[model samples]
Target chain A: MTAMRPDLERTASALFAGAPDWTAIAESGLPRLLVPEAAGGFGGDWGDAEAVLRLAGAAALAQPLAEAMLAARLLADAGVALPAGRVTIAIAQGRVTDGRFTGSAPAVPWGGASDAVLAAVGGELLLLPPGVATPGLSPAGEPRDRLDWQGAAVLAAGRASTSLGKSGVGDSAASEPDLLALAGWARAAQVAGALGAALDLAVDHVNTRVQFGKPLARQQAVQQQLAVLASEVAAAGMASAAAAAALDAGGDCRLALAAAKLRANLAIGRGVAIAHQVHGAIGFTRDYPLQLLTRRLMGWRSEFGSEGAWADRLGALAVARGSAGLWATITG
Target chain B: MVAVFALPPFAFPDDSAALRGDIRAFLARHQPASEPAARANCWAVADPEFSRALGAAGFIGMTWPEAYGGRARSAMARYIILEELLAAGAPVGAHWIADRQTGPLLLRYGSEAQRRRWLPGMAAGEVFACIGLSEPGAGSDLAGVRSRAERVAGGWRLNGQKLWTSGAHHAQVMLALLRSEAGSERQAGLSQFLIPLDTPGITIRPVIDLVGNHDFNEVFFDDVIVPEDALVGVEGDGWRQVTAELAIERSGPERYLSSHALLAALIDSAPQDPAVVRVIGELVAELWTLRQMSMATAAKLAGGEDPVVEAAIVKDLGNSFEQRLPQAIQAVLAADLDGATPLLRCLARLLLVSPSFSLRGGTREVLRGIIARGMGLR
Candidate 1:
């Protein structure tokens, strides 16, 4: 019998049901894809990471899985001692130094809300005190806090100059394929979750709502609309899973990941529009989760990058090589 | 082996792979006459031996009941078989209409007499079928069909012309949708009938396609007489029946895989060009996405759900990709062709066949209309 990973399902279901104390779930059940056998982690591969991220996205989790994965990724990149839970690592645009890591990073996930901050001081990893809040920074949600503070505790200090790589992650000297793969899977998963939610909402609404004395679902037109949504969700889901599996297989997943993100962004945007149409006037209000799903979809459309960014990446790839070359790279 | 993208569990059991294997074995054993053209003029082989082979292999009547020598397979299973045949460029043209639409329609709405009379032969691939839907004046506006069928003593008299009838030249019967009553609402007056193509009053004139293939014909029904048993369903229900048939027509992998030969050729004849890698990658991704959507729709259709909207969406996206293939390939080959073009010939072949991608089943605008209506915007 085939079944979904229990840990991922548990974490996602809890988040979807609005579980308040999600951190416990995240700590125990999250980052299963990132934690390795050597570091007391799950020792799971990118396929596991993709599955977890998909569940997380489907559940619309607002937890710290991404942040922790980011931390694990950075630690793995730096080849340093990994920290226990309660550490949060985020990317900033500038450098950090002794007893203080200073830089302006906006819209960090779980930022301003974490117990600790790992800043890339120059090219070296530096741990900063949580109190060193950067003022004028705001959390996108209630669980996050953004602030600006003076010089704070710098965990691994005294690196004269450090440089983050082109991808804006630390460890400039070496490539971080795992971390990049995580970002790709994470973004794809979130889009999957949002798309799944939109489809569910639409299906539920049409099944119950009465139009012309018949349930909307009975109408051929309604059925057709739901079918469209279902197809998009199906495609997006496949793309997400393919991206994850490629990463697990240690193959070049950049093409798969980009395709997944691009498809997700486009599909979810279309899905939300259809959801609203099916839900009618009630879909527009804040009382409904529709607004939240839509906002997150819009946000995630440009989170790691937007549709345009991925399209450009894909287009550039096609232009750099030929169409046949691109197809072979993706399929072959 | 093609890279299999992750998919939702097979929605239903699909024997398409097996179907393909069976069909391939049969095709190999009974290869048709040699054609000077490329690949039997793009799988247009209408050879009787090939058709009889498929019928003998129990590969025909994929979705029909076993009562008429049918298999009672799900649509998804049939989809797999058809897709494999089409993608491999098999000469399935002889029985394409019978297997795809007419047989299923007959099963759904044809009288028991009609089913017993026609389906067994169809299942055996002894009878070829063609569609008489599109007319000289009405292409997309199917409701405006003017092929009038007047009530007669025994059955009816059909007098009108059907344009673009693929396989009509060789078909034994044409399942035609025509207006039975004059001066009524466009849809209310329509009726469908199964008329033998060799009837005295029927004439089929070849209308060669762009590839100079006689696959299509202008089928003219000038006072053609048909028995009452030829009526497909209750008079004035042709619109409904036709719409249902459109669902069968549009919701399949064939809608997207029209250019698959080009895709396969490009991969097969791959040159060691660096830029070719990038372009092929993007095309592969698009094709993969389209396949997923097609598979999902197939699953829904197999579940006895009407996936009209989903089908429209798939057809739309698939057509876009098909039409874009020429541009995508040309962009890559233009620079190289200027230096030393080897694949230009293949690209040219694709360009020649690409226009039908958006035209054959339903035009892009028609699909968009259906999609808009589905979205409740119309």
Candidate 2:
């Protein structure tokens, strides 16, 4: 299915274009859009949500939209009752020792602002209330808290749903969600969006800012750099779209998500450098909106899984499959 | 705001997998006896025998009309065959230019007579073609070509020198672009001529590459005459035709699969090395991503949409990935070996030939310039 929801994308852009309002996002019913209508929520598919998430990223909307959408899907998949208000998800290395959750989750997105936290443990999903752990912030000043589950009471806990295999939409009666893959998918979309924004800013800047009595865009070197940036953005966008489509098709999207994140991270590495170079002094300043998008790119790329980490995971999978099986692993 | 640069999601048709299996079986039976180091040449190595065998199996020009000896398959089917051939390092280079661009170009722009004369031979792998775009005076700046053709009584007389003409010596036909009007503006008076290489007053000399390969050549045409039928498309439409041809040239598996044999070798030889595995995984991931992009572009082209910007983006990034692959592998395998293994030997060959990856199709700067212009920056 095509991921072009022009109406939803326009609404998302208008709402998140400047300073993001979590209350507005929640009020717009966008956060729970992925939750099935049978579960008392809007029944939008992953393709629809992909549009909103990508626009949210392009507009540099600093809210918990992606986290909330992912958390709602995970909770629905685990058969947990949907929570009111904003929700965030975190994968923590903890255990249910003595009927109480005890572990630490570092860099939980919107951990402080979220009303509830869905912590994914080994083969289980734990719902933790807010203020149950110490909060932290990401490099971009987003609410990425360090979650300590020691002595925190779990409101609900259940075994995560195994893959439902390939089934059509509204057939969620069998499939379970993979929290990490969902989160990685969300981050990939955001990175793609941010790259898009950075590319736009760089292009605009190069075309307007004059150097040597002509627009910087006239310089072959500058044009080359911008072109490279655009290519990376295009590639990242494609990778992210592929992953979203895979998830939408009810397939195990771990491979797609891994590649998406890897490619997105690589895009961020080159995209941000060229963007900043194009904008020069203004891009480095706080006044320009370029930093808002570029900063998120830097922060979001390292979240869920860094490039090296995902590369390691993907590489391990490839090695396990061996040379003979490599092509099938990719195309299958 | 820029319409979100994206390749719409796409996959091969249902029958492609079976077709892929058939190709794999064919490859298993007909693999060359070359070592992995030689196979590392990938799609760049020319082998007419292998090409003929592939054509015998009905793999070449599968997308053309059946009347032209083709199977009239979908573009995705052709894509599958090409990708499989390049991935396995099959020596289809002898027919690559004809199958990929020349045959398609003629099908799109050539007259009925030209198609009837050339299509079946190309589809049967009995004809080879070479592009004559870059001239001695004009490289990336194609508009600066000094090659000129003058109108004669029944045809045109051509005079020009083409540089870096791959397979020119081996090709039966040359799709040469020449400026036919002396005072016309840039990109205005160019026209394509389908010249037979055996025409009188044409000379081809080898331009040995860094790796000592004889694939590239320089061809000079002095007062060469061709019939009026040699003109492709309407006069003065060569710029548009060549531009369209490049989209086919740039957005193919050949752009990125040049180092695939090395990659396969690396995966086979160092499956346990963590550093090597990580790099290989990253490469594989990138490769998959690029293929998806290229496939999406192919789908768009099949749908009659001109994805010029998208094709340029793929070629630029694909070239960068391939050109840097050897260095990345060298970093991971930090051992001073004297071609002790096939992996090392492949690595050496890739290192020598990698520089040409960006130079071919289009240089990085030229591609990026096209991309920037597409993004409205220029």
Q: In terms of DockQ, which candidate is strongest?
A: 2
User: Interface Cα RMSD for candidate 1?
Assistant: 8.5
Model 1, range B1-378, lDDT digits (tens) per residue?
011122342322333446555665766776533321243224345766677787887778967899998988766667666765665566677887898889989888988899999999998988999888899888988787888988899888889899988788778999998999887767788988999877899888999877566777998878888888888988889999998998877857777766665655555554456455556555666776776567777787777878787778778778778778767767776453332433454456567767777787888767766764554432
Best by lDDT: 2
C-alpha lDDT of residue A311 in model 1: 59
CAPRI classification of candidate 2: medium
Model 2: pairs clashing at backbone N, Cα or C within 3 Å: A136-A145
Please give the RMSD to the true structure for each candidate, in Å: 8.9, 2.9
Model 2 TM-score relative to the real fold: 0.95
Backbone clashes in model 1: 31
TM-score of each model, paired residue for residue: 0.67, 0.95
Per candidate, native contacts kept equal 0.12, 0.71
Per-residue lDDT of A212 in model 1:
95
Docking class of 1: incorrect
- Candidate 2 segments whose C-alpha is farther than 4 A from its true place: A2-4, A151-153, A161-177, B32-34, B182-186
